[model samples]
Target: MFDIEYLILIFRDEFNYFMMKKVVKLLPLQHRNKDCVAIQFDFNDSIKAAVMKVGAKWSKTHTCFYILNETKLKQRLFLSLKKLNCFVDYSAMPKVDQVKKSVNKEASLPKSHAHALQVFEDYLIGQRKSPSTVHTYRNFLNLFLNYYAKRDLASIDLRSIEIFLEQVMAKRGYSVSSHRQCISALKHFSELNLGMKYDPANLYMPRKDKKLPVVLSSTEIVLILRSTKNLKHRAILGLLYSSGLRIGELLKLKLGDVDLERNTIYVKQSKGRKDRNCSLGQRIRPMLLNYAQTYQPKVFLFEGEEEGKPYNATSIRQFLKRSCQAAGIQKHVTPHTLRHSYATHLLENGVDVRYIQELLGHSRPETTMIYTHVTERKIDEITNPLDSAIQKFNRMDNETPNPLLSRNENK
Candidate 1:
């Protein structure tokens, strides 16, 4: 009897250990138009409850529990699950380091192409192109070079470039914007390296799809701002809306850029590499002061976990989504939406379009004019033609009086 009881106990212990070691996979999924990490595992009540505690939600469409796929949130979920003795398999998820390594590995070029690419890169850097622009142009040039690796670089003409672009579009499903960038990249390369002077009129570029910017109403904006309880988060969203700073520009802000006395924020080398000053809201002054004291940022206005590093934009986006959800907002809101709302609100308040242009740092007036179409100020003032015509007909009918009604009254 003692031997049989001991064997049963050992078997139960082994079974429990195996159950605790069950694997749960975290998958990349697009849920409700937002990137989310889906937690997939064999159904277990305990694991489900634990995942819920870590803020994972069930998606009917995807048939899995998911959480916002931010770095910090992923780390939190991993740690939380580990504490519950759940094995997490996150190998399927993409990592920034892995992506960088993959890109580096794929960057091989032939000897001739490598020399030309180097020369082109040096030229771009010498011309003071932004890092992103240089990287894009180099990648496009590399693709073109690799396609015609056997042919002489100087021998390539506009016709060959067109064929390459057509093939790429068909294969990769390139959008109009990407197609335009590829053209621009090739044009620059042809002019600089191949000594080709192609006429701009000859290049047939596709028209860009016109889509209006989404603007949140003042009440909704207020709700979103009020819902954000964290001072740092509130300040970030507040600055984005109040000053109309682009996400990149906001992330690049340093303590020295803000001038409390002048009530202005110096935006240095923004889009188009232009520097501009934006008005600082008096309301946000106290908040900024309090945040500065609380956070005690060493370098950038908003630093990440490590000192002197600019705060991760992904973190800002993650918190903004949470704030919008807490505010009961259903719209797809992004950081740029705040900037759009800022411009539209300014336009509705009778601010000159030219002044709005300067504030937004737009190179052309037409770019600022887009806000005019979206502003509700003029739209609200004008009555609909159908409504006006209906009202007039009703008044005329009442005054004329129906003949049948008159006859009936006589009877």
Candidate 2:
């Protein structure tokens, strides 16, 4: 197979060896006082049986599973984690998997707003806000607090907050998105945290213009794949294009979510906390298998250098940018561009728009209908009226041989 043709192979594998395999979502956190390892895992019979086999118990306090973290059960616990691909690689003696033993603790907050930030974080967790939201909202709040470090929380009102937003917009020259995010954070802090109402004017932000997503051609996508040399990077590009995954969804992928045997990827806990199955490209199957065997990613299909964490969305963006440059695709493409292209190309291939909606995990058909406007397939099918008229006139002249024109030509 030539370079780009490598992406066109079809694979058939009926047996699901990964069916029983479990993904350890959050690798067990060792709670010394609790004397248990708090493990977050996808629910499966095999996993439950493993927990029972270890005499492990569930902890409501931590909202996770607890295996007795004693020397007696340590080996058994590590073995149980094998299904998650998180066991220590005994081949490397000097180090072990941090997921099995280490905790990913957040950095300490500044002293000025530590207590208030803690309250906000606790509130977000209690409300079951997604991790990304918690991080973003917390950062925004931190900036707000940092702007007026000495201002008393109770004394500060909407007027003071509006000034801070003005500064953010004017001095920082940030977009409306940031300005709106700041307003949202302040609102959350005031209403939810401080139990105070903010003025409506302080919270108001102008609506942003809706921009259509960029879609790449299939040939351009192939060129990008051909340009990417690393196996993992290629697999990432292939999966992004083939599955039409959002960057967040791609990052959240667990080893268990990929079922090569079924040629499907289960997208769990997406935008609306909904799980959906997406098609796995048969051509990319071999690439995935190779990455799985070589990288041995634990907890996620693709992981960061950090032991337990999934691949960072920002880094993947950088990879795409570089791949685009190398492929000489001038269009400003992001990860979502591939997704838009996927939907558009599927539409071109005569796939029903409604089915495309499900594939993209859009709840509303209207949201999916936007592709119809941009799809060149429909536009390409349309013939120009002038061209048709010219063709008809030419045919008539050729067949009937207009006498005046024929006489002039003979003269």
Candidate 3:
């Protein structure tokens, strides 16, 4: 959550002082483990004339001073007082400033659990993790932090983290891979932001179930592209499939990023905020150039109706859904599917894993290697043991007399 104490620093007068009479002190302390206010002040007689006049009026209402209105006064008043320069001599008035300072210090100190999230985001932007990976990390952090608000990050034991993971998996119905991702994000955040080392030795990442990456056949991909005839829709899908661009990267593209002559498109601030150049297929270059001429987009490549701005990520997804429905493709295909198909096709065409890594803007070659496993080369070579056994049985049957013929002769 965004910090609230800063608001208090901006609005101090109406809350801490009554006319000329200043509240001598205010302290935040716990009563029955609940937040409660402790206040102190001087009477009118002890102050100067101006201060006295205001003090008399304030002194008349003793009950008002102590009983903070939970609805109207309690929290906002404290916030407001912080704003009005009332903390000028906070240290001189140790009774009030000391307590407030402690609170401020606590607020400034980054929460260990929360710091982990920021660190992971930094890595994502720097390392250029895939959009899906970044999104999953963000969702996991938000859910985890929202679950444990105002709790001391250092005090949270391993058991707490495990329990939270279990709740997400068992009660929240998260897959094992998702659970592991949540753990990975949190662990990175803690180590980078809070200086809390999460040793992989003691902590076991949940075994991720190995699943094959789904790839559409070349014919099916062509069919989907053909189904979407509109220039904008076609361009979006074309860029995704042809360049292996993520939907977010495609949506964030600026017009200048596309170099028509060189047949390269620059991806800026991608998954890890890393910029890279992706090849624009010569085939789509004319189509894109034509669309550019028709649209005349100002900044973003894919202009929307609102004065040529790029289409939002959500809108792009909506367009893809509409296009899929129009194409009558039975499989549930998204823009990312186009990217997956692109990578698989590259592998099938004998593009080296190292080269694919650079084209896909993957930080590690291992990540790009997953596409190799999804290619047709592996699937085509897969021979079933049962097929060999069946062939042998057929050969034996042909060499020997048929069982039916032998039985008929005996009869």
Candidate 4:
């Protein structure tokens, strides 16, 4: 029954061997390394011998040594000095985390009924609407909603839309075409989202001006064709006159749609997505064949610079503009002018109105009848008031004045 005093030792570094007098404790030699005590201590040989007498096991892991005692054990636990690196200190970190947090907060803030917009977009895509059309419609609705953030869908009445259209016209100076586009987008959105038909009566859409289609004279058409330096331009203008093709129809022509043997061009999925066959004259067939051979376009009849890409309508329109300016023509000529000229020339040549209608792919013959109003011979054939008065004057000059009126007026 003896108590032994022991010293606690802690090593700073294994190689340096710096020992420090950490603590001291007392314990019975017989109780060293005993299982009765739950906690144990470890130290060097001198410290181990003192703790082992008290039934405590030595641990190589700890950097400190412990002394066993009757009530408590004294130990100095050596901890490695942690060197502060880039990540350990908050101030040393980049500003990216703060920016990211701010971004996340703003992004998570809902985009004015995001769920509703997503539903509308999905419905539009499901209906096989064109991607551009879908984007336009979706953006229109988003602008409307974001502009009037306070108003709910139920609160957005016909009157609200009407007022918005007016504001758009007055403030944005949108033309009839643009106004119609806005109305169209909203109408589709309302149909899909609110499950209600948008009545045109509810909206005060601007009246689209009824401008007569510009028709090129046959002489002007010839001049425009002759001004073209490239085979492509010549062939395009020729086809425009030959097939009565709108620029859109011309650009959409695939390689296989042209029939060289029959001298015909197939207009696939035209304006109203209707397909029609148009005659290709034997005259322009050689030009077309030459253009085909020269360009060697793989897919589209008129391949653009981007490999197999089809000729864009806008580019073709610009080409026509440049060609018209070069030709020194005073008339405002468009690709559509060639189409109008084709119809007007046909009508003047005594082609049946119904036949012209069929050739131009007009749904109704009445639409094609406008050419009749503009035909030169049709206008000249009508009896003029001047001609009637001239005949009466001629008869009087040759024979006598009106006897009763002339005699009475003299008296």
The top-ranked prediction according to lDDT is: 1
The better-scoring model by lDDT among 1 and 2 is: 1
For candidate 3, what is the total of clashing residue pairs? 18
Candidate 1 per-residue lDDT, tens place, 185-215, comes to 7666655644443554477777888989999
Per-residue lDDT tens digits of candidate 3, residues 11-74? 5665555454345454443332223444444543332233222211122223223322133334
lDDT of 1: 0.84
TM-score (C-alpha, index-matched) for candidate 1: 0.79
Candidate 4 residue lDDT tens string, 214-289: 8887888888888888889889989999889888788889999999888889998776567888999898988988
Per-model TM against the reference: 0.79, 0.61, 0.59, 0.65
lDDT of 4 at 367: 85
TM-score of 3: 0.59
Cα RMSD, each candidate: 5.7, 19.4, 20.2, 31.9
Candidate 1's clash total is 0
Residue 19 error for model 4, in Å?
A: 84
Better of 1 and 3 by lDDT: 1
lDDT of 2 by residue, 1-411 (tens): 365545443211212344434555434343432335565666767666676556565655567766654555667766776855442323312134443343222233445466787788788788798887788778777767766666667666777777877886546655677677666666666645453336655566758757777889889999999999889899998999999999889998998898988999999989878899999998999999998898988798999888779986756776777788799999988889999999999999999998999999998998999899789899998999987887777788888867542255545
lDDT of each: 0.84, 0.74, 0.66, 0.66
